[model samples]
Target: MNPPKRPGRRAVCLLVLFSVWWVAVATVGFSAETVSSEPQVKAAFLINFAKYADWPSNAFEKANSPIVLGVMGDNKVSEELQKVIAGRVINGREIVLKRANSIDEAGACHILFISNAEQQHTPTVLDQVKGHVLTVGESPEFLEKGGVINLVRKDQKIALEVNLTAADKAQIKISSKLLSVATLVKGKAN
Candidate 1:
C-alpha cells in the first residue's frame, strides 16, 4: 500500500495563511456598514472551494468532463467568476461557467451559485439540485433553505457558513481544511 503524500512546506504555509485569514474574519466582526463590492474576491473563493470539495464520480459526464459553474441571476458575480475561472483547472478538469435560468439547467452544473435575484425560487432550485450539486448563496436564508454554503458579508468582509447536513444529503464531501475556516450550521431556510 502507498502512503499518503504529506503537504509540502509551501502548501503548509498557504494553508496557515488561509486559516489565519478565516479566523480573523470569523472572530473579528466587520464594523463598517457600507463597503465596496467584492465580487472578484467572492469569485476567487468559489474557485478555491471547488479545489477543496469532493464530488461523486457520476457528477461529471465523463472522465475528462469540465467542472461547470452555473450562475443563476446576478450577472455581475457571474461575469467576475467567469473572468477568474478562465483557463483554470481543478482536479484535472477545466473550469467552465454557465448562465442558468431553470432548474434543469442548474442540475447540469457541478457548482450552482444562486444570486439574490433568484432568492424567491431558492426552494425549487434546491430541490432540483439536491444530492447532485453544491449550492452556494449570499444570504443566511440560503443556508436555512438547505444550501450547502452561504457567503455572507459581515460588516465589510466576507464570511462563510457551511451546512454539513445539506452537503451530506447531497453526497458531497467538503474538505476538512475548508470546514476548519467556515462556521458550520444546519437547517432548512424558513
Candidate 2:
C-alpha cells in the first residue's frame, strides 16, 4: 500500500487563513443563486462542525448515545446530510439523522438543521431547543432570530455566521478552531 499523504506547511497555512476569511465575508455584498452543489457542501459542514464542537456530558442519555442530527424541513439539504453521515461515527458516537416537522419532535436532537421551509417558525423553534441544541439555519435573518449558526451564501460560496452568545445560552461549547473560521456575533434572538 502507498504511504498516506500529509498536508504541507503551505496547505496548513492556507487552511488557517481560509477559516478566518470564510466567516469574515459572510455579510459582504453578494448575490444568491440556486447552486446545485449547495446541499452537499452544507451537509459536509454540518458533519465537520460536530467534529470540532464539544458537547456537555449530559447532552447524551448514555455513553454510547448517538449524536442525533435533526432536520426540520423537506429539502435537498436534509437528503444530502443523510447521505453524507450514513454509517459515520464521531468521537465513538454513531451519527443519527432524524426528520421532524415540529419543535417537540426535534427537541431531543444535539444538532438541528432548520430548513428554509421552517424559516417562519425560527423563533418558536429556537425557543424549543433553547439551552440544548445547536441550531443551524440558512436564512439571512437566522442569526437575528437566535440561531447558533447561520450559513450565508456569498458569490456562490458558503460562509458561516456563528452566534457565540446564542451558543453560550444553549450551553454549547464550540471549538476555537471552528470559531477561528466563523464570523462571531452577539445579540438577543428576535
Top candidate, metric lDDT: 1
List the candidate 1 regions with Cα displacement exceeding 4 Å.
1-36
List runs of model 2 lying over 4 Å from the truth.
Answer: 1-36
lDDT of 1 by residue, 68-170 (tens): 8889999888888867788898889998999888888888888889988889898888876644688999876898888999999886788888999888887
lDDT of 2 by residue, 5-41 (tens): 5667667667867976876565342323424488889
- How does each model score on TM-score? 0.78, 0.78
**lDDT agreement with native, every candidate:** 0.83, 0.81
Q: Model 2: which residue pairs collide?
A: 19-181
Q: Roughly what TM-score does model 1 have, to 2 decimal places?
A: 0.78
Relative to the unseen true structure, what is the C-alpha lDDT of residue 159 in candidate 2, on a scale of 0 to 100? 89
- Candidate 2 C-alpha error for residue 136, in Å: 0.2
